[model samples]
Target: MSHEIRTPLTSVKGAIELLTDERYFKNNDQQSKLLTIAHANTERLLTLIGDILDFSKLDSGSLPMHFERQRIESVVTQAAQNLRTLIEERNIALEVLMANDLPDLMIDPNRIAQVVTNLISNALKFSPSNAQLRITVENWQGMVRVGVRDHGEGIAAENLPKLFKKFTQIDSTSTRRAGGTGLGLVICKGIVEQHGGQMSVESAPGEGSTFYFTLPAAPAGAPSTTAEASA
Candidate 1:
C-alpha cells in the first residue's frame, strides 16, 4: 500500500522539484519556496518508503542479487565517486587506499556498491567538515575486504553491537540530525551476508570508526560468469 502511493508521489515530486529550479520560476520567490518545501518532504518520504521496502524484502529473504566476478577497486571507487559532490560540499578529505593485486570478488557489484555507499554515507554523517574519510580495499584471509574509516565521534562499546540492528541508532539526536531511517547498516549487512561475506565495525569513543566487510574472492582459475541469486 505504501509503495503503491509512493510511486505517483515520486513522479509528482520530481516534477515539483524541477519547477523549483531558479531558471524555471524566474523571480517567483514565494512559489519557489513552496515548491522547495514540497520537494524536500517528498524526498524524505520516498527515502523512508524505500528503506522500509528494502528492509522488508531483506528480512523476508527475497532481495535479488546478481553475482559476478568484479574488481573490488572498481566497485569501491565508483561508489565513492558517486558521492564526490557530497564529500566536496563538506570539505571532507576523501582518500582511497587499495592494496596491490587484490583478488576479484564473487559478488553482486551493484549490491556491494550499495553496501559501500551506505557505509561511506554513515561515515560522512558523523564526520565533521574538513575531516578525512578513508576507504581501503585489500585481500584479507583469502577474502577481499573493504573498509571505510571516518574521523568522527566514534561509536561506544555498547552501541557498537547495535550498529547493524534493524531500526537502530546509537545516538538518536546525532542520527536524526544526520538524516537516515536507521535501516542503512542493517540492509548493508544483509547484502554482504547474502554474498557469503561478513560485515563488522571497529571504533573507540574518540578514535573514530572503521566499518568493514569481506566477500569471498573468486576461485582461482574460475571463469568469470554472472549468476543470479536471491536472499
Candidate 2:
C-alpha cells in the first residue's frame, strides 16, 4: 500500500514543486491559484496516508513503545516548539504551564510527544484567529496530568463521547473545515493507554474543550532507561 500510494504521490508532489518554480512558470493569478489548490490537496493526501498507516499499526498493537523515565514538560514543550510556525500562522496564543517539582513519568517520549502534537493541532484547527490555548501539566494525586485547553466553538454533549472513536468525525462547520481522517484522537488514546494511562475530554456547546491524559509517576528509586540517557 505504501509503495502504490506514496510513490505516485511523491512523484506528483515533486512535479508540483517544479511547476511552482518561478523559473518554470510565469507569475499569473489563475495559474498560481490552480497550483496552490493542487499543492494543498497533495499535502492533505500525504497527511491522510500517514494517519491511516499509524492507525493500522496502532490497531494491530505493532507500534513500538520505548519506555523511559522522563519529564513530561520536556516532551510537551518540544512538541509545541515543533509547531511554532503553525501557531504563528494561525495567530493563536499558546501557553504551557507546568507545576513545580513534578515527578517524572514512565512513558515513550516520542509517542507522548505525538499525542501532544495531535491534541494541540486539533485545538489550533478549531481555534479562530488570535484565540488562546493552554497546555498545563501538573501532579494529580499520584499521577502526572497534562491537558490541552482551547477556547473554540466547543463540541455538543452528544458528540463528546464520540471524539475518541475511530473514524468518528462530528458533523459541524468547524469540523468540516478542519478536514481530518478522525484517526488522530483515537490513535492518541491508544498510545496513552499503552503507557498505562487514561485519556478524556471536557467540552460544551459554545464553550471550548480541554483534552486531558494522566500517567502514573515513575516509582521512586527507578533508574532511567540506558537507551534514553545515551540518546
Candidate 3:
C-alpha cells in the first residue's frame, strides 16, 4: 500500500516542484496560487505517510533504542534552539527552564529530544503571536519531568481525550491551519513509554495547556548502549 501510494505522491511532489520553481510558472499568478495549494497538500500527504510508517514500526517494537546517560540541559537546549527561528518568526517567547540539580537520564538523547521538539512544536501551533511557551525541566519523584506549556486559547475538555490518539485532530479548522498529521504527540507518548516513563497533559479552556512527560534518571554507573554500538 505504501509503495503504491508513494509512487503517485512522489510524482505529484515533483510536478509541483517544477511548477513552483523559478524556471517554470514563476510569472503566472494563477498557477502560483494553484501551485501553493498543490505543494502544501502534497507535503502534508508525505508527512502523513511517514507518520504511518513510523507508527507501524512502533507497534512492532522494532524501533532501535540507543540509550545513554544524557544531560537534561543539553538535550532541552538543543530542542529549543531547533525551534528558535520559528519561535522568533511567530513573535512568541520560547523559554527553557532546567532545575540546577536535575539528574542525568538513561535515554535515547535523540528520542527524548524528539519528544521535547514535538511538544514545543504543537504548542507553537496553538499559540498566538507574542504569547509565551515555556519548556520546564525538574526533578519529579525519582524521575525527571519535562513540561511544555503554552499560553493560548487552550484546549476544550472534549478534545482532551483525543489529544494523544493517532490521527486525531482537535479541531478541523485549527488542524488545517496547523498543518500536521496529528501523530506528533502520539509519537511523543510512545517514545516516553519506551523509556519506562509516562506522558500526560493538563489544560483548561482559556487557561492554556501543558504537556509533560517523565524520564527515569540513569542509575549510578549506568552503561551506554550508544557507546557499546561504537565498540
Question: Who wins the lDDT comparison?
Answer: 2
Q: Rank the candidates by TM-score, best first.
A: 1, 2, 3
Backbone clash pairs for candidate 2 read none
Local distance difference test, candidate 1: 0.86
Any runs in candidate 2 off by more than 4 Å, and if so which?
1-4, 23-26, 221-223, 226-231
Report the C-alpha displacement of residue 211, candidate 3, in angstroms: 0.3
lDDT of each: 0.86, 0.89, 0.83
Superposed Cα deviation of residue 50, candidate 2 (Å): 1.4
RMSD of each: 1.9, 3.2, 3.7
**Candidate 2 structure quality by residue, lDDT tens digits, 18-39:** 9999987786899889989998
Candidate 3: list runs displaced more than 4 Å: 1-39, 226-231
The local distance difference test score of model 2 is 0.89
At residue 106, give the lDDT of candidate 2: 80
In TM-score terms, candidate 3 sits at 0.82
lDDT of 1 by residue, 167-210 (tens): 87777565778877789899999998998899999999889999
lDDT of 3 at 61: 75
Expressed as tens digits, the lDDT of each residue in 83-154 for candidate 3 is: 899999999987778889988888888888888888888899888899999889999998899999999778
